[model samples]
Target chain A: MWTRIRDFDRMIQAMDLFNSRLGGVFENYQRPRLSAGTWGVTESGPRTNMYDTGENLEIRVEVPGIKKEDLSVKLQGNYLEIRGTRKAENPEGYTAHRVERGETSFTRSFTLPSEVDAGKVEASLKDGILTLILGKAEPAKPKQIVIS
Target chain B: MSERQDVTVREEALSERNRQIPTVAPLVDIVENENEILLFADMPGVDKNNISINIDNGRLALSGVREVKPVGAVIWEEFADVEYRRTFSVPQSIDVAKVNAELKEGVLLLHLPKAESAKPRQIEIKVG
Candidate 1:
C-alpha cells in the first residue's frame, strides 16, 4: 500500500512538473527550463552529491558521455560552477534507428556550505564521474579545543 | 516500414530488490548499418565488472549497479546507489555468438551482427 501511494505521489509530481513546463512554453521557449538539482527531471543537468569532511568538501557529479576536454570547473571563494557539453555521437555511414541522447550543454553552479581555499581545490574525472575536493579555509577547518 | 526490425526494449516490472535499490532505465541510442546494429547506453558510475549483458533465445538483458559512498557527513545528495536494468527483444537473425560489447567512460557499446544467412546476397544468372 505504501509503495502504491508512493507511486501515485510520484505520478502527481511528474504531472505537476509537466504542467508547469507546458504552462509557459511560449514565453520560456528561448530560455531553457533551468534546474540545478535532480529532484524531478532526467534530461537536465547531471545529478550531484556534496559531503563535508573535517578539512575538505567533496563533490561528485555524474557526467556520462562527457570527455575531459569538454568539461570545465570554476571556483571562487564559496561559489563553484560546472560547465559541460555532451556532443551527439552519430557514426558515419550508419542510419539512426533510435536517438535519445542529444547534444546538451549545461551550466550548474552552487553556493557551498562553507568557504574553500581556491588554491588547493582538486578535480578529477574518472569513468565519466567528476569529483571535486575543496579544501576548507583556515577558519572553517574543524579544530579540537584543549580541555581546562 | 518495419522491414529491418532490429530490437525492442521493454521495462521490467519492479520487485523486492528493485524497491530497495531504485531501478532506472538508462538512456540508449541505437544505430545500424548493413553489417550490424550498434547500441550505446549511458550508465555513469557503474563499473565494468558490475555490469552484465546476456543474450539468450533472441532476448538481450543488461544490468548494472552503481554505489555512491560519501566521505564523512552528507550535506545534500541528488543521486544515490541504484541499479540500471533493461531488456530487449532481439531478432533471431542476429548472430548471438559474434556479439561483442565494450564499456568506456560509463557508456556501454554493444554490437549485434546479423547471421550469414540473413545478410543480403546477389545472384548471377547465365544466359543459355
Candidate 2:
C-alpha cells in the first residue's frame, strides 16, 4: 500500500509539471497578432492538383468580401498574375461579440504549359469563387488518324 | 457504487447527445498532380449561380454567404448560421492564364496547372 501511494504521488507531480510547462508555452504564443505569411491564407507552394488535366485547365481562387471591379489579371510570358484588394469593415464602439473579418490585398500566379493557348484566357467570378478557363493550343489537342 | 454508476450514465448520455450536433462546415478535398491541382469544396445549400471567386495582389480569396431566412414561424431548427471564408497564396509557377473552375452538385472544383518546367520528362535508353 505504501509503494502504491508513492507511485500515485510521483505520477501526480509529473502531470503537474507537464501541465505548467504546456501552459507557459501556450501563453507565450501571442493571440490576435497579425500573421501575414501562411497563417492568414493557404500557402502558395505546389498544390496537389497541379497537373491533373491535359487539354483544359481550371483554376479557382478564394477571395472573400472583394468586389468584382477591384480584381485585375495580367499575363506575363507563361505566368498569369492576379491582383486585388479587399477592405474590411470595422464596427467599433459597441461591445464586439465575435469578429471574423479578414480584409486585405492578395495576389497569386500560375505558370501555364507550353501547349496552352495564352491568347484566349477567360475568367469569371460568381459569389466568392473565381474561375479561370484556359484552352489548350492545337498541338496539345489529340490527333486523329484516317483509316483506309 | 450506485451513485457513481448513475453519474457515469448521465455523462455518457450527455456526450452522446453532443455527438449528434452537426458541424457547420463541410469537407474540402485538395488534389495535386504533376500538371495541375484540383480543389473541391462542399457547400451545401449554397447556390452555384450566386457564387464568386477572386484572385488579386498575391492572394486568392474564397467567401460564401449562407442565408436561411426564417420560414413561417420556426417549425424545426438544426442549422447554425455561418459565413465561409478561406484564402490562399498563389505561387509564381502556375500558368494562371489557363486555369478553370466549375461548380456542380453543391461542390466547387478548381483546377490549377503547373508551368512546363515544373513537370517531369522521361529519358530514353541508348543501345550500344
Number of the predicted model whose TM-score against the real structure is largest: 1
TM-scores of the models, in the given order? 0.77, 0.38
Give me the runs in candidate 1 sitting further than 4 Å from their true place: A1-43, B1-19
CAPRI-style class, candidate 2: incorrect
Go through the candidates in order and give each one's DockQ.
Answer: 0.29, 0.02
TM-score of chain B of each: 0.81, 0.64
Off by over 4 Å in 2: A1-54, A91-96, A145-148, B1-45, B48-128
Best by DockQ: 1
Q: Write candidate 1's Cα lDDT for B1-128 as tens digits.
A: 56532233435334322224556677788998888999998888888888999998878999988888778999877777767777888988899999999887788899999999988889889998
Tens digits of per-residue lDDT for model 2 on B2-66? 65432343222221121111122333555566677666555533565545667776576665544
For candidate 2, the lDDT comes to 0.51
Candidate 2 positional error at B35, Å: 53
lDDT of 2 by residue, A35-125 (tens): 2222212323111112224555555554444567878878766687778775533323323223333356767776765556878678876
